[model samples]
Structure formats: C-alpha cells, structure tokens
Target chain A: MMKGNTRGTEAADGKGSGPGRFLIRARADTNIQLGIICILIIILMTALQPRMFLSSYNFESMAFFMPELVLLSIAMMIAMLTGGIDLSIVGVANLAGIAAGTLFGFLAGEAGVGGLGTGAVILGVGVGLIVGVLAGLVNGLLISGLKITPILATLGTGQVFIGLCVVLTGGPAIVGFPSGWTWIGNGKIASIPVPFLLFVVLCVALALLLERTSFGLRLKLIGTNPKAAVFAGIRKGRMILWSYMLTGALAAMAGILLSARVNAAKSDYGSSYLLQAVLIAVLAGTNPAGGRGNVLGVALAVAALTLLATGLQMMRVSNHLIDFVWGAFLIAVIALNSLSARKGL
Target chain B: MRVLRNSNVVIALILVAAMVVIGLINPAFWQLSNIFSLLKANVVIGLMALGVLLIMISGGIDVSFTAFAIAAMYLVVRTMVAIDYDGVILPFIFATAIGGLLGLMNAGIIHKFHMIPLIVTLGTASLVRGLVLGGVGTSNVNIDEMPPSLIELGRANIVTLERANGTTFGLTAMILVYAALAILIHLVLTRTMIGRSVYAYGADPEAARRVGFKTGRTMIFVYCTAGALAGFAGLLHSSMSWLANPRGFVGLELDVIAAVVLGGCSIFGGRGSVIGTVLGVFILVMIQNSLILMGIDMTWQRVVVGGVLISAVAITALRDRRSPA
Candidate 1:
C-alpha cells in the first residue's frame, strides 16, 4: 500500500524525475521485471527459430495482430482498476464490428468491397463506436445503477452481445468491408503497421487520462477501498459508469481493428481473446480486486504473450499446450511474487 | 428485522411461473418426453452447479469446474478406450477420483498462495485443459469405440414412453443418480456438523478461524467435493452423448454459476440451499431446452438466457439492498 502511494506521487510528478530516478523506479517495479522476461523471450525465440522468428514478414504480421490483444488487455486493465471486470469486452468488440460490417452490407448491398467511398467507411465506423459506447453505457448502468456485480453483469451482457452477433449475421462471416476501412488495420505509416501506430497513440492518450485526470485518481481510490472513497465523496457510481463506458469504447476500437485485419467479422471470431485478455491483464500486475494497473505494464505483458505465442507456434506446439503454459505462468507468477514478498519481510 | 425474506420462496415462485409460461406457449412442453429429456440434460450441469454452490458457500468463487469436468471426462474416456474396459461403475469412480485430485490441486494453490479463488481456478482450468489435450492428444473417441456397458447404463431409464408413431423417450435413470447425489449434499449441508462449519466460515472467514474451525480442512473438503461432482458430471455427459470430445463443455462454468446464483445461493457466500438450486437448474434447463418449443431460433437462445440472468440478479440485488442482508 505504501509503495502504491509512493508510485502514485512518483507518476504525478514523473515529469520532473531525471533518468536516474527512472532507473530506480524501473528496478522497483514488477512490470520492469516482466520487461526483462519479454526481452529474454525474444532473445530465446530468435536463437531457437531465427529463420522464422527474425523474419520481417513475421514482424509485420505481429504488428497487425498484436494491437487487438494489446487494446483488449488495456481495456480490461481499466475496468480492473475499478475493481470490476468487463467480461463483455470481446462480445462488445464483435458486436461493434458487426454493426459496422452489417452497415456495409446495407449501404453497398452486393458491392461492398471497394465500391464504397471513404466517407461511407467513416460513417460505418462511427456507428460501430456508438454501438460500443452504448454497450458500455448499459454495463455501467447495470453495475452502478442496478447494483449488480460487475463480473456477473458483464458475463450476462457478454452472452447477450455475442448472441446478438450471431443473430445479426445468422451464423456466417459478414464479409466485404471496404478497402479504405481495411486500411486502418492493414495500412502502414512509414514502416510501422497502422494498427500498431493506433495502439501506441491510444496507449499514450490513456496513460495521460489515468495519470493526469481526477477520474483516474478517483478510480484508483475506489479500487483501493470503496468505503474510503465514498467517505471522501468520490461519486463512485458516476465514476464506475464512465469507467465501463471507456472500457467499452476500447473494446470497440479493438473489434474494429480485428475485423478490418481479417476483412470479415463473425460471432465466434477471437473467441479465446476474452479469457486471454484476463490472463494478460492479471499478468500485467493489475490487481484483480481493483485499484492498480498501468499502460506500460499492459504493453509489456502483451508483448511477452504475443512473442511467446508466436514462438510456440513456430516450434509446432499446439494452441492447447500454449494455453496450458499461460495458466501455469499465471500461478507461477503469483507464487513467485508471494515468495519474493515473504523474502522482503 | 428479519434480514430479507427467504429468497428461496421467491425463486421457487419464479421457477413455477417460468414453467407455466413455457407450458402455455407450447402445450407439448408439458409432455413427459420433454420433461424427461430436460432432466437428463440437467444432470451434467446440475451436478457441477451443486459443487460450485459449496465453494460459494465457503466464500470462494471458482470458474475452473468446467475444466475439471472436461479433464476427468476426456481422461477417463481416453483410458477406457485404450484399455478396453467396459464397466460403467469403474469409469464413474475413476472419473470421480480424477476430479477430486484436480480439485485438490486447486485447493492447494489457493491455500498456499492465498490468492483469489477465481483467478487460481481459472489458471488451473487452463493448465489442466492444456495438459489433457497436449499430453493425452486431442482426438474424439467415436461411438463405435465406446464401452458397450457404459452406453447401456447411459441409455438405461426407469420408464420409457412410446409415441404414436413408435419413437421412444426415457426418463433417464440418471435423474435418480442426480437425485441421490443432491439428497446427499442437502443432508450434508443441513444435518451435519461440517455443513454448519461451512456456513460459519463463509459468513466470516476471519471469525471462523478465530472461533477454532479448521479453515484449511473446510476449504479442502468443499473444493474436493465440488471437483468430484464436476468429474462425475463430465463422464456422464460423455456417456450420455456416447462420445468424448477433448473440447467439450466450453463456457459451461458461467451457466452453472448462473444457475447457482439464480437458486438464491448468495454470491457473497453463507446462504444457499439444494432445493432452491435444483429449481434454479430446472429454470435454466427449461429455458435452453424449450427454446425449440417456444419457436425461438436457436441463435437467440443465449440472448434469452443472458437477459434472464441479468434481470433476475438485478431484481434480487435491488431487493437485497433495501434490507442490506
């Protein structure tokens, strides 16, 4: 708790801190330890499968695929900061994409590929973002206004949203997103993939929101202790509602990129990403009970997981085994962290 | 003030109302055939729900029971197929044993690390599932390879009804198995000393520890019992279906948890009952099974279920808040 507060102050005045203090902070942070692990994984994978892992083609694909998971992970992190989880994020994403994709079907009819103008794409995306925000708003209402538990409420909403995805498309992929729309997922700014650039820009923007804003600080206080936050007059319900909406918007952004990358949206697309995002968020040291997490930590966790997944695939390890490895990794991290905490005592 | 009125009564009324509504929508839904099938479907999910109810009563939440169920089911099926064993009793026992051991692992981690039960179980669930698929191989055992005796047991029923055209439906004897187990659980939770200890522990873990209850033992027993139930359900599901897929029972934890909560088992723990839970399971089973009878498209089934879950909890939560029970 003391360390959390110190870091709160550190981040608040982080602009004044020199590189020396930064190094100390890095050493003090578990996320930086995770960063070292990420480095180790990259080095090990490159050594083991230089031909596959080191290729520009592999890197390019990674750039495209990694952003969706990264975005999802951060979305999850924000919700966790409020001591709640949005199990509906994956559902929200698919629903948002389906909104955009289905709009394309309506506007362009049978000729949706390159037939639509850039304006049509923007309009469709706008509808998708609205869908995402609205989904988040409902989750916020259920959790805050109706007083339902976050996990259960979101789980139910998730089911409803995923069901709506199937109802919308009727059990098939909605293909034919316009070329310009796909560019958000596929295009490059300089040599970097557009998705990755978007991911970086959003992460920075979110970091600022969390670090510099009253909303972020209040969320942290609520996460740390809800009663104390209430005592301090934090208007907990409004904060929770907004937090969920933000989570929804982030989920929608990830969904839009995902469908664009694949050029289609389906009900079951990225079905595993929900739990995987949970795993990633917890691995980033976001307290599951709420009150603590950061963008940098999430970025590192996403990097580590993406690399590990790619490396395992390259080595011909089945996806199931990789999941097993991730589960094991989570427990091991918990155990090791506890052990280290004991040693400090 | 009596904290809140017994939610058991409230939920029971809801369950009956749902049944009546469905029956009104489709007269055929009242047929013994549909009811029998519903009971059969309820067995797998119901067993798992009963086990989770125990965990929740201990102030712990688990999302790993589905993993345990699948693991036990897949491992037992794989072994039986390999060894050419045919007896139904042995597979159930083995499945129960396997599930108990996996549950022990979950208890061990949560106990040793003092971590959140949900996250720990989630990890173990993923890990165990991975181990089964990766180490044991991810192949579905075809019906032809299934043990003859096992299939016979799964197909066994107390009574069979012949349709006008000659098709038949049986009230799967599995309902008896479910009833027998549920009765045992109900007795344990009500008539036994350990059961009272579970309630005390859930009501306040710290106080329970200070009051001299064996906290660790209660946790172990609760999780082990739940895990064993999951394993039993998993194998029965396979046998009843006459096939075992390595990827079966995905996302079932949420459903069972939903049922448990609907039954009035408080998510915060120390409050639940078997009768209420059974009724809750029946409600879910009816909703899912009667989707066909209601003329609802299959794709919309989940939406209906999700909608019901959210509203039910929301209503109950609002009521609870007024009294702060």
Candidate 2:
C-alpha cells in the first residue's frame, strides 16, 4: 500500500537484492532445516528401535496413508499460496464423501438404478467430486467476490456443508460400497499402493502447474501484493476464486478416496483431517502469507507427520498421547514460523 | 432510514421482538425461574464470548480456550475434592490462575517463537484436551461430592417472580455474572488505555508498534485475560452441571467464533465490542429457544445455525466488498 517500494527499489537499483533477498534465502534455509529435522527423526527412530521402525508393516502403513494426507496438504498448499486459508477443506471432504456414499445408497436402492454396478459407483464418485468443487465455489464467491474474510467465510460455509451432510444422512454412516471402488483406495501398482501413486502424480502435475505456468505466476504476484497485482492488470478476485475452487476439488478427491477405502461414508466424515492437513501445510513450509512454497516440501511434511503418528502407534502410545504430541508439534512449528517471519526471513 | 438500518439498533429490535414472541407463544418460557435457568446456561458461553471478543479485537485467536477451560475445570474439581477445600473462592481463584498461565503459554509461543496463532492454538487445544483425558482416565470426574452451595447457584434461581399461571421466573448468579461482565468489558474497551491499545493493535499492529505499543506484553495480557475468563466460565459450567465432562465445550470455539462474527466483529482482527458479542450470543440462543418452541427437532437445529452463520458472514462479506482492502 505504500508508494515507495523498498524491496523493489533495491532490486532495481542493482543493490544485489538487499535485505529482502537475504530474507528469501533465509526462508529457503528454513526449508532445508525442516528437511534435516525429518531425516534426523527417521534416524533417531531407527537407532532407538531398528527392528520396528524399518519394518515392512510400517512402510506399508505409510504407503496407504500417502494419498489422503498428501492430497489434503496439497489442497491446503494451493489455498495458502493464494494468501487465503481454506478452513472448509475438511468440511468439503466430509460433504463430498457423504455425497458419494449417499449416491451409492441411492443407486443400490430400487429407485430405478442398477445396484452396485461400476457405472453407478463411478457416476456417484464423479458427482461427489463436483459437490466438493461447488463447496469451494461458495467459499470463493463469499470471500473474493463478496469480500468476506477467508476465515469467517469458510467457517460459515463449512458449518453449512457439514450440516447438509448430517441432514442428508440423518447422522448415519453409509456402508456397502462396491468392491471395485476399493481399488481406488487400496489397489497396488508394481507393489506400490495405488493411492500413493496418485499422490505422486498429483504432486508432479501440481508442481508443474505451479512452477511453470502463468497461473502460478499470477497467484504469486497476487499473494505478494494484491493491490500491485490489480494495478498490473491481474484479476485478483477471479484468481482467488479459482484457487479456492482448486483447493475444494483436491479435498474432494481425497474425500472420494477415503470413502472408497473405508467402504462407507458418514456424516462426520473427515472431521479429524482439519488439524492434520493444516499441520502438513505449515510444516511443509508453505507460508500462510502466500506466494511461496512448493509441493515437494508439503509432500515431505505429510510423510513426516504420518510417520510421527505411525511411530507413536507402533510404540503403543494411546490415542490421547498421539493427539497431544501432534498438537505440540503444531504449536512448535507455528511459533517457529512466526519468529522467522518477524526476523524478516 | 439510514439510522434505522444500523445493525446494533436492528439487533436490539430483533431481541425485543423475539422476547415478545416467545412470551406470547409460551408463557411458561417467560416464567422467572425458567428464564433465569436459561440465562444461567448462557452465562458461561457469554463470558467466553467476551474473552473471544478481546482476542478477536486484538487480531489473534485462541481455539485452545475451551481446552484450557476443560483442563482448569478438571484441576479445580480434582483439587477441591482431593484436598477437601470447602471454600469456593480459593478453588475458583486457583483455576483462573491456571487458565491464565495456559493463555500466557499460548502468547509466549506465538510472541516468542513467531508462529501462526491459529496453528499454535489448535495444537495446544489438542494437547490440553489429550492430557486432560489421559489424566482423568476412562471414568468421568464424579461431582457427587461437590459443594452444595456452589451447585445451588448453577441449579436454582435466587430471585423468583411468580405469575398467576403457576409459572415463575427468577434471576440467577449466572445472569448477574453475564450482566457484570458485559458492563466490565464494555468499560474496559471504552475507558482503558489497554483497551484502546487493543483496538489500535488490531487496527494496524505495524502502526501500533511504530506508535510505541508494548506489542508482546499486551498480547500476553490479552491472552491471559481471555484464559482467565475461560477458566471462570469452565468453573461456572461445572458448578451448573455439577460435573466437569472432559468433552465439555467440544466445537464450542466455533460457536463463539460464529457469535463474534455475527456480532459484526471482523475476523481480520479489528473493530468489535463485548456488547456486540453478547448480542451475538443472545441472537443465537434466542434462535435456538425459538426453534424449540416451534417444535423444531435437534437435527434441524444444526441446519438453522449453519444457515445463520453463513448468512451473517455473507452479509459482512458484502459490506467488505465496498471497502478497499
């Protein structure tokens, strides 16, 4: 908002990027720091209990978790990069999964639809994905078009979406999904989990879209300086809408897979994912301030979190303990990030 | 016409209309005893809303408030019962102190470590909740041994007004607490230097810093105040219910947040008042009460609340569109 741009002027005057450049480098250092921490954690786990930490079962569990956790983080990353937070991701996923489950139930019923057929299930999942995108659209429209703060906008819509899911299901779980649908959740390709593969593929596609696309540039510019971007002929409102929608769609994808894996959909689906997805985003070094971060970091953060949870489970820790540990980790990261941001990093 | 469109005036009108409608529909709802009972039930939440109002005005949030309160309640109840401390004031003071300490921890983490408030609060929320649950074990704290005097204020109205229809309404400590807090917070916001600093900080922390505000220290104070209020609310909750459930205030942060937002507080962190928050809570509670009178089921209650929450935000969003970011 200031007329004089210190960072831009320094760069333009050939002052070797100045303090702002150093700040960017420092941020990159933080990423490397997080990476090292992850490796060290893995090493410590191995040294403490080699037999258990390196077991095939642990790896298998991690593989199974890769899809939902990674995808959720990616969704959050997209929103974060756009200088907005999608508090509704978990709600959207829950609603989408419920939609799929409801559709499966309807198709299986005698409403003139085939029972448990591949075609019916596929159609149901497709509709579920659309529901997710629609949820995002609502969030986007309310936030960008109507100028609502992202937090309040999503909070409101999230409640509505969650309530809708409850109303649709009457607060029950929908089970008896088709066997073929489980493949999306559990099948393997070359001994690698299908979901994990999808996770990797989504990361690559998103990374490319983010790093090498005009859309990505626009988003970064908007995030860094919305007013400047607007002055530079960028459509800030439209981009925000698009990003929220993308986040919604990605969360929906995760929801669809979750429904398939669990073989059911419940009204309260994906409630636990909120804290986890947020942690993944923050840990991955995706600045909630936006215009920074990449998918690779987010992917690793997801791995680290999932590992932490799995390790705790392997150590036979109680669910309550696991929750506490996760919370402590989140606070630690947030505090660390905030300090770093203050240091002009 | 424009004056009539003022949200506060409109809300006041709505509140008055709601009371009249409820009174007409069910005179029983207007009974002094029942009215006080409802007011008591709302007091704890109303107090928490006041705390939240401060945090919201200061441009930070503590989702962990509920968790902190739960932990405090556990400590207070367990200590009171275990130590055979008969006096209510001492335990309440200790609980409030513990709650304040937790708030200080949250502020310390954010101010000292430089982390996002939401993430820090969320993590702390989970951590506190987990610890409380783990400490309590599978069995809920038995309040059968609770002090009767403390329990009575939560359960029975102190002042009753009887009607010819054999129904009565009464004033309770809960209402007194609410009214007192409302006045206190309003005065604090309007009359105190710290309160002005809160607004200035929220309005523009960068500017506040330039103007020589004690950003870190003030945040600690604000959060601690919020924490203390939450603790007091938790105590009241336990006293009223005569039990401290580990799952108390589950998803209550959302309700508080919704109330604040609906009361026209900007989630962006500046420009809200305790009066607005109280009104927000009142509107929400009134809606719930009205729905019950209309024979609306609990299942539909969620839908109605959700709709109101979204609509409020949407309305705010529309207003925000007219202003430059």
Tens-digit lDDT track for model 1 on A101-205? Answer: 998889987664579889989998898889999999999999899877776789889989998999999989998789988999999988889999999999999
The Cα error of candidate 1 at residue A55, in Å, is 1.8
Restricting to chain A, the TM-score for each candidate equals: 0.91, 0.89
Per-prediction fnat = 0.67, 0.62
Q: Per-residue lDDT for A10-129 in model 2, tens only?
A: 212221223557536744676687688778778877877789998998888688867887788888888877667788887788788888877776767764333466787678778978
lDDT of 1 by residue, B211-277 (tens): 9998888888899999999999999998889998888888788788888878887655677889988
Residue A28 in candidate 1 has what lDDT? 45
TM-score of the second chain, each candidate in turn, equals 0.96, 0.90
Chain A TM-score of model 2 versus the true structure? 0.89
